[model samples]
Target: MYAATTIGGGLGTGLLSFYLGIGVAALLRTMFGYDAWDRDFNATIGYIFGLVGWLMGVGMWGTWGREWFGLKIKDPHANSRKELGWQRYFMFNVDHKVIGIQYLATFLVVFMTAGLMAMIIRLELMGSGQDFISNKTYNTVLGMHGIMMVAVAVAAVVGGLGNYAVPLMIGADDMAFPRMNALSYWLVPPVAVTLLLSPFLGGLETGWTAYPPLSVLTDSAQTFWNVAIITFGLSSILGGLNFVVTVMFMRAPGMTWGRLPMFVWSMFVTAWLALLYTQGFAVALIMVTLDRIAGMGFFDAERGGDPLLYQHVFWFYSHPAVYIMILPGFGIALEVIGHFSRKPLFAYRYAVGAFLGILGLSGVVWAHHMFTAGIPNYLHGPFLVATELISIPTGLIFLSALGTIWMGKLWLRTPMLFALAVIFNFACGGVTGIFLADVPTDIHLQDTYFVVAHFHYTIVGGEIFGLFAGIYYWFPKMTGKMYNEKLAKLHFWWMFIGFNLTFFIMHWPGIEGMNRRIADYPESLQTANLIVSLSAFLLGSSFIVFIYNFINSWVRGPAAEANPWGARTLEWQTSSPPPVENFLTPPVIAGHPYDYGVPGAAPHVTFFPPAVGSPAGGGGGGQ
Candidate 1:
């Protein structure tokens, strides 16, 4: 089944490519008097021919010969157990759980590689001047770190845990389009490898933003960066489309829009944003690639292309991309908040409204990223107002969180610790964001470490903390074993302290006008640089605790019971590391997802399969 799907997709893509190539050649010949037959044209034709040949071999011949010759073809309906072997990890598998594990493992690998780059960066910044590597090498390391972390942020939770758990939690058997889900996961490896090897192509120096005129004139790595980013954007779009379709079409019988898990709702909004905005980044990168490869002038300042135009297009996607990265975190925090509090989520309707509102407002405030790029003064005020207004909805998230945690039983498990930490860190991050959103303050903080510190507080503080919370909360479900609570707490504290120590003082440097993306700073700031670098090393080292906790817990920790958290969600009703099909029998919804304090009534009821020992084939009593 997987092979057939791959071949069909390849053929479709090939036929489309062939037509596009022919059209391009005709346009060139007709408009510029260029010859229709050229070496480049022949190469394109050859590539298309190769694609067609591969498609024929895999799809037509493989399928027909297997049927006619009575070959003992592999069982498509074989149990998922055999399908989940290590070999299948190399190929496309329709199992959302398997894909989730794949995404988690893949991003961990990339995260470690990026972490190594970060170590190099810390080493370089250990003193005021360069020590271990040259400025160019430092720049490359920094650039790779930025890009890799961004990739991890984008994929880790949504593509990993969300892919694995969202459908199950929502009571669906699988995503609406499982094949596209597989495709999205498969795109990650090639994109990751390309970015990993970009240094060999001449490392990029423009950072992940890849702003215009500089990116256009940069080396081959910049071109590779453009291609890798475009490919990643395509992956995001596919994943987003699958998510939207799945949430909209695949919910179980009784799951209404309001009954949907907050995490799932967050993903639904996030998918919508990704679908709409990623294309702008894709097109912007393609234009940069064209300028590099074909000398097109979409962003070429020399050719009358406005460099600021590239910034506009890039940030249009990226600003919402920030929400894309953090919205799931918001969802995770909300989930954790309710579970730990042993209460219904406070302001559930308001939280949902906020998610949708952020989706709407994210597009309008993207220009805040470019406030210093010389837009007109009148435009700045409108952008500032829009940017500040987003805080209204964003503020609701905090209100909901605080309201949930205020008067309920607070569980301080590893997950809860991370969740509480998310509130604290995000509060700090959010308050600081106002400085960037306001035009007058942004003028001073625009390119300095202040902006860097602000976003790190938001992205790393908010998203990464929320990610860890979700991981610790869902670890048993993913692996069927409990993590070490002691170690997990240790990891949480170390990371929380180290993270703040590293980034908090960074505001001082930024306030003192220390620019970002520089290899060296003045000797006057050496003491502060030393402090930040040391703290960063400690921050990076804290991951060691997480590594130990994850490994030791998976191998040696006690087995977890279903519903360990005593929560009222569909996910906890099933076994730890749920069955192959997620639910043996589709869950029947009976009440709100977070109803506590009902007399003689549990918030949830599990409908078990006959094999699970329910003679009536369904169970309705509370826990």
Candidate 2:
């Protein structure tokens, strides 16, 4: 049954739908005299419909479509194979584990693709002139890289680790809406296609923000980018909704609010932030698309549209979007800290409070991004105060992390090292952000390499570092194999050193008056540009080590024990890769989710003894 809806089916159906849509649009234009629409308009609509077809052809209909029509159905047995085969990942399987791996694998490819584009950008800037690619091509590459990496930062952890670990940690067999979860994931591939396909439509150069007036007037490819962003946003919203429902209503029998793992709590809070704020960005993009396709005057300044209105709306979500990216990193870091340090989470309640505080403050602080754009002078002080105040909640995260590792059994594993690096990098990001928050400092640094360095430190250094930590920390459980520790450490040091060396020096050029988004720069900035570019190349190459370690370890490394880390989370209470149903039986919650350092602390959960000959009875269950 599942064979019909393979990856090939998805690609074929999507391509057929796209061509069919173009054909129908052409017919309408020629035969029916509907000549107002151009090829770009038709292409945009075609891509949207093609995405629908792709999802339908990817087997979403099997799990969700039949049930939607009230059809009584038997189990499709999609993931019935005891061994986790690679094919299940290619098709739509309702298993959370499969969905998680799908998200991770898909976005890692996107991340590396974007990283390659970054390499091109760095290479172009290396000689301080048009050495390689044309300036037009550079802008397009920069825009593409920005949007693609934003998609990765937004989806990789939440969609990947959040999907795989959240359910098991909460002792739920799966998410509350399994089909919705799968649908959210299936929505991403078409987005990737649209982003990559845009250059063919004449390319876009407005950068990831796509601020209109410029966006309203750019190449028709902007239409493709618009649709891609809207699609990705929709996927994010649905995924967030699933996390909220699952965490709220799906915990095990004795699991309670206070006892939830810090990571789960972060996910819960992050889901609400995603649910509430993502709509603003989505609506902003839709309005811009309408301006392009329907002549809607929402952002057209000549049409009496307010360009700044678009900025207001974009940053309304984008600023909070930063929090959305970093909050999970915070949770993952703290989770690693507690386990490796062999200590209870320091100031657990305060950390949770800080999360809540960050969420509350996020919505009001959007105007800080607009300080240099001539936002009301009267409003400047308030925005500055609001932006500066956010550090208090953010500071709690660092304090908790440092306090947890203070004088404890600090295990400097790959994950812990990455977690520690997150602190250093994020501190750099946070301090620089304070400068950007102040109107005076922002007037100096806005749109410079300083701005770029600041955000990369925050997002790449903070979120990506945490992402690596979570991946290494959970690799044992996810793959049921121990990664090569030497290679892993080498990957860590190479990336960490390379990342800092690249971005850290970028501040000097920014302070010395180097503007971003331009391919060429002054002769005086040449030496700095050369160094940064070379450092970036080395930073980019470190992932080669990571990719090798991930794949090699998965295929040939030693088998992992279920409770290799001896953490007390519910996920660790199950098998290394976990059973198809997650546990031998529904687990009975035993105590707090993180109870390290407390004498005689109980295990977080205990599974019922499996019936005779069950997989759990065969020793796949946790210790």
Candidate 3:
């Protein structure tokens, strides 16, 4: 029956292996006469072992790992393969759709968790000094909120929506490496669990950046935080590689690059960004970890190590990591806009070029994030120019979106409304970004609430809006059911109004000398603080609507038509909720996806097998 390989078995084995890992590290350290009781050293080693155990326990060992040692791999879905409903999602099933749903569901929980932390932060800041929690507690909450939100922003769209849609869009049976795809998703839970457990081990005080000497010297929680993020970065890199490979080699016959859907293009660029640039964060954290566990002097001033080095490494990844997050958001927004606008995508090639442009420019703009961190004046001009210059490509996306909407028959569904908000919200974020990109203004507003406002407007306004759009747009396809349109719209307007209200006022306080990352502010700012806090609660409450709608609709909503949007994309040609192989017949791309109202356009896809031994696309699905 293979009853032991479900999530339950994974948890049991994970706990056992976690203990074994810690105990072995302690034993080895004792033999070497090192500090066996050292929390940082032991925890770091223990986490590595725990991560592996968890992955194997969750079904990887039976399904994939056994192949490494000449043993037959067991079926991952043996226990519940016959039932084939909810239980399959709990194990390491190699279905891209299942993995996508897992990623979405997991990260949605992470998003809400972080959002609640944000409200708690807003609560503390609503008045002044020492409202409830101490400064240390506030910092921990802030850091937790920052990191978790960043995680949600980074993975939710690409892992969740990208996984589910890309293969189907490209007309492939599954990802090029299905087990590896499953592996990337499985890596996520350990990262999340490790991060959530850190506060109990003295908490993470050093914000998401975890910069330099403070991170190097903080308690074991920082160690856990570092390890968790490093694990997350690995997941990102692997997922990126998988996406790059799958899109390259796994496409249907005649699914040429130019004919690829906009969302797929966005993800293609994002995947490259992830594969190539995620190393910046991983390397930075690894140094921090080595410094903590091995007594390395990577950032030790006494040992002539440069503290500024860490900032450089971290932001190098962290900044482009912004694009890594937002590009997919834009991708989703553009996609929904295309289908709902009932018009051909405007400047399609230009939009694709813009994606490539962002990819080319993303790595160079990393230094802009470090301007106020003490860099040479000579370096400032180049970074500022580079930072602002990247906007040209992004601006093309805005043009493409607006152009599609102009003079078109608008279907303002929940997804479309949310998609439209991406442009409106990101326009504001982009304008504020100019101030921060300039050297003088950045020096003044470096750690202020203005930066906070701009950051959220860009990520939450632009990307989070895009995230919701993707959720709504694909809900019918993914669940084989329709959502409540009325409830969905209610959530959209409430969240839109509340989000703008909360973050827009947040900019005023920054301009008025309210430093960010603070638990306290002057009494003069109390009124504005209260308004933002109350608005934040409103923003938080909107998710309740979303949660209820998402659950109720999925469980009891009307069955959806396969081609609900009447779009030309290959995915829509398949059954709603799709088949195990994605298509009853193999799909073949015929022409571009968004040829709406082109009078005599070829259908985007047709059913046929791929040519035998096609060279296919570049890149692989492996990490």
Question: Best by TM-score, which number?
Answer: 3
Candidate 1's C-alpha runs over 4 A off are 1-79, 82-87, 600-602, 608-623
Which window of ten consecutive residues has the lowest lDDT sum in model 2?
613-622
Q: How many backbone collisions does model 1 have?
A: 0
Tens digits of per-residue lDDT, candidate 1, 1-623, equal 55445545655655566566656665676677766664334333433443344333333333333555867544322324645455455444667887888898898788878987987887887788778888778888888999899988888888987898798888887788765687687667657766887787687788888887788777547876776688789889999999999999888767789888889999999899999999989888877877775668988666788888888888899999999899988999898888899877899999999999999899998889878888877789899999999899989999999999988989889888888888888899999999999988999999998988898998888888988998999999988899988888989999999999989998988989799888888888788888998998888999999988898888888999887898888888889988777777767776778777656654565674546553253222367
Residue pairs with backbone overlap in model 2: none
lDDT of 3 by residue, 502-573 (tens): 999999999888998999989898888999999999999999999999999999999999988898899999
Q: Ten consecutive residues with minimal summed lDDT in candidate 3?
A: 612-621
Q: Scored by CA lDDT, what does every candidate get? A: 0.80, 0.88, 0.90
lDDT by residue for model 2 (518-546), tens: 99999999999999999999999999999
Best candidate (score: lDDT): 3
TM-score of every candidate: 0.88, 0.95, 0.96
Per-model C-alpha RMSD:
6.1, 3.8, 3.1
**lDDT (Cα, 0-100) at 369 in candidate 3:** 79
Give every collision pair in model 1: none
Clashes of each: 0, 0, 2
